[model samples]
Target: MDAVERLRRLCIDDPVDDAADDPGWSDALDAHTVSLVRIGALIATDAPAASMRSVIDEAVTAGASLQEIVAVLEGLIGDVGLPRTVAAAPRIAAALGHGDDLVTDAEI
Candidate 1:
């Protein structure tokens, strides 16, 4: 499966918990976030960006609004914290710019 599919399965199978889990939780979360950031960067490329944007735009057009997208992104950022999130934002923004009305608001 693709990284996004793998990530979806991971999310479905194992809900993240920093407190209840073992000491390795932080490392695992970091690894997962890094992988996602890489995927975001890859998706931002000219070839993949169009496809990715189309999917995201369809989702948004269906029911998901820009705020919802931003909330999901911010939640991911909250999970990973500011430093990592800040580092990941540009790539993610680039990727997201292809689809929904992402860059319109300053909140993202």
Candidate 2:
């Protein structure tokens, strides 16, 4: 499963301009934006929560801001609903280093 994900990232998250030969396709969206939407779709489609952390990490490196990532999740609300959004929030937060299960929780 991890290997599948690694391959997916290699293919889907490649920052190279595969659009080099096609003008119309290349004109549509930037590579960073495309990577972000792919991550959003993975989230919306209910991919494993743990798997998303790495995807999110790659998206961040490719210039997708936290706000943009949240927007992608928000866009799914109409189709997937509030419950999914609620569930995904914590996962995303965890990836972003704000999960509730911090060392502070253990200290208390």
> Highest lDDT: which candidate?
2
Residue ranges of candidate 2 with Cα displaced over 4 Å = 1-28, 101-108
**Superposition error at 18 for model 2 (Å):** 11
Top TM-score: which candidate number? 2
Clashing pairs in model 2? Answer: none
Q: Write the per-residue lDDT of candidate 2 for residues 1-108, one digit (tens) a residue.
A: 244544565688753343355433345678787778777777677777677788888788889888898888888888788877666767777777776764244321
How many pairs of residues collide in model 1? 0
**Candidate 1 minimal-lDDT segment of 10 residues:** 38-47
Q: Each model's C-alpha lDDT?
A: 0.48, 0.70
lDDT by residue for model 1 (1-108), tens: 344654675779863344355333344545434434434343333224445455554544456555655554566654556665454444346555632454434433
Please give the lDDT score at residue 30 for candidate 1: 56
Q: Where does candidate 2 have its weakest 10-residue lDDT segment?
A: 16-25
